[model samples]
Target: MAAQAEPSLLVDYAPVMLWQAGPDRARSFFNQPWLDFTGRPLEAELGFGWMEGMHPEDRARCEQVCQQGFASRAPFTLDFRLRRNDGEWRWLLETARPLCQDGQFTGFLGSCVDITDMRQAMEERRRALAERELLLAELHHRVKNNAQATTSFLGLQASRATSPEVAAALRGAATRVMLATLVQDRMFRIAENATIDLGAELLATAQAAVDVVGRPGIVIEAEMEPGLLLPVSQATPLALIVNELVVNAARHAFADRPAGTIRLALRRPAPGLGELMVADDGVGLPEAQRRNTPQGCLGLHLVPRLARQAHASLRLDVDGGTKATLRFACG
Candidate 1:
């Protein structure tokens, strides 16, 4: 038996194989000259002695699998860490096949190969994606700020124009620009992606409209329910409609008044419906100009157009001052 085992060492295959007689009775043997690498006799280097070369975290698991393989007469495949010749712990892919005979339980044979680099690369990719999303959010904030500055400049130009035709046209352009700006401005403040708080945007719009006049005596009162909050989809037309109605009141409704009061209110009148009213305590619409004059008829006609755009019905009451009420779908 010694002569046969010695000759097997020269076969150019692994000369040592690990085996177990029972659960805790594992052993390793090498043919002929191969035994010198261990620097110990076969008996001392078997069973629990192998723990010195196996990582502490891996030893218990490896012993468990070996015991299970012997009891079940099945193959064992697992992954674990091992101490290498360089004193470093390396990850290994371990596999063991049972060597049963005639349906009786037998030990398992196993080998291992190294996958640490692959796991580290996947972790790096995850971090890179997180950083990219952070950069995109910052870019959106900067772009919003720049757009608001441009809209403010346009408002200033409209305020300075001397011609009525030029001024009215400029005001219209400025109002549209501001409506667009308010969508993003309120969205940023509220931290929503595309929706805005209608109540907040409405207040801001009224304030922005008042800022155009630069007069102190103008008292603008807004009675709004918290329900004024709407998404940008609904806020856009509502804001523009409010803008036009207020502009008309400031420019024409208070033409001969000593004291002026403009009242604005927004509320939900019924399910799925919203109501808005703008009224001023300036001079009421002159009966002749309200119906006949083209120059004075622009605001009245345009208010309906804007209301129609938002699917709203416009009603005008000229009893004391111009009161334009609009009711429409919440969408």
Candidate 2:
């Protein structure tokens, strides 16, 4: 059999070492670099002597894999902790291939590379990502609480207003602010690992709207398909649109009715499209406001613009009663 020196191989590789057993079961040849790295003389590192430097927990597995390679004449690779000269446990990736002569296994050659830095870096990154998510959740919670306080203040001011028009305007403003706060709260509440589920979001928005307008005479009903999830970007606009439509229905549609129902439904309109419809069995929209009113209400203007941003469409069904339909891109 022809023998090759460790440093003479052509391929670029990390530092390597070689050991061959003699007839007396002692190392016959030990590489120069291995002696320098271990800071030990050839006598102390031969056979099973190297186990003294490996982490005690890893020594058994390392020895077992090395033995398998020696007996089977196959390549082997393993990752383990090894104690450095300074008594620190460093991670290492070790690989080896068996040596043979005349089709009989003789010894093995191997290489070791330090992976301590890489492992530490990965751990640090994981901790930083976890911290960032915690901070974001706390910030969203505080912002939602502040918004609720502002809505309460607005409601108090509306109650004290002398003019009916001023009270109505203040109430409208408070409703809009509440809608924005509810959207933020929903986004933060159901997010799993920083992603919002669109289906759950829509369902939550429907529930929140009903809660806000808790009128005893007006019955709120919602029908939605399961397993639809929207990312935060798409969910925000859809929630606000639903909020405006539902609030409008509760305020104006059933203003004079004894028994009324407001239905809010979400369904798939087409591929990559999510559709919502809000209809009430009360007074219909005025023809002038639906067709020719130059300066539309803020809610009307905002809902249509939001639908457009979603690459969706909006329409008001004024034939029988007030029904607002919205179609938007979910993809």
Candidate 3:
């Protein structure tokens, strides 16, 4: 048995500021909340008096929007700065709809909510995001320079080495340095996307396998699931394994062939396990040396160590062509 509230009472005490305009496109009424917010009498706020509180910079655009809506008898929404009772400028999001009486257009009704806090919060987030991107760019540049310098020094040492074995070892070390740098670059490019899943950085390295190996006749076929994520701590070692396998295939698989294909793939075959495989269709490994490391190929000798570092088991196959698989915990 609560008394029913009157329509005028409800409108006057509504949470949002409300207003009305007549068929003549002049402001006809403003509720008590609107008067309280602007510290103006109802008489003073009627017929464009409310416009006096709008920010000068937004006046023309806001007026134009209202005028357009009035002309078409349509609903309209706008955001603009309006002066508060204490003279502080505050953002307001206002929406209006045409009012009809007995199928005839009579006026418009509008409501507004203060949005100053939301506007300021959004601006702060934008500034923070811009600063983060700037820092990441600088980091990527510095990392690239340092890694390139190291690789250059290693190459120089390999060129100056006296023994064939020493030179090959130095060259292999330089190749490792280069591949590690490439993995870091790919990691940097994997954005914590606002749209899709995060961190499948291995996909970038897999797609560019042939280019990274610098083998003229090698074409890499990269197949990767879009959302396969890897642990950052193990990413570089996993990348090195793939890099070494591709390098071996490019060098030994194609002896006299002008073109060959290297199929590189990374997939989560089980709930908590991942697989990275590299296979090439060229010369198969000799049966006698298939079980052991290929003779004189210093790079393949280190694949087992790299696999251990990644906490992965290495599997070698010599069917039709050489296939290398690394199984790891990458859930």
Name model 3 segments beyond 4 Å from true. 1-3, 179-191, 194-208, 211-214, 217-244, 251-261, 265-277, 281-331
lDDT of 3 by residue, 28-78 (tens): 989999999999899888998888999999999998998999999999999
RMSD of 3: 5.5
RMSD for all candidates, in order, please: 14.4, 6.4, 5.5
Q: Write the per-residue lDDT of candidate 1 for residues 118-232, one digit (tens) a residue.
A: 5567779878867866785687677767666766776687789888788777666655555556544554444333555566667677667766755456788988878555665
TM-scores for every candidate against the unseen true structure: 0.47, 0.67, 0.73
The clash number for model 1 is 3
The positional error of residue 220 in candidate 1, measured at the CA in angstroms, is 1.4
The TM-score between candidate 3 and the true structure equals 0.73
**Residue pairs in collision within model 3:** none
- Least well predicted 10-residue stretch by lDDT in candidate 1: 29-38
Best candidate (score: TM-score): 3
Question: Any idea what lDDT model 2 has?
Answer: 0.72
Q: Residue 247 deviation, candidate 3, in Å?
A: 2.9
Candidate 1: where are CA atoms >4 Å away? 1-195, 286-300
Could you tell which candidate, 2 or 3, scores higher by TM-score? 3
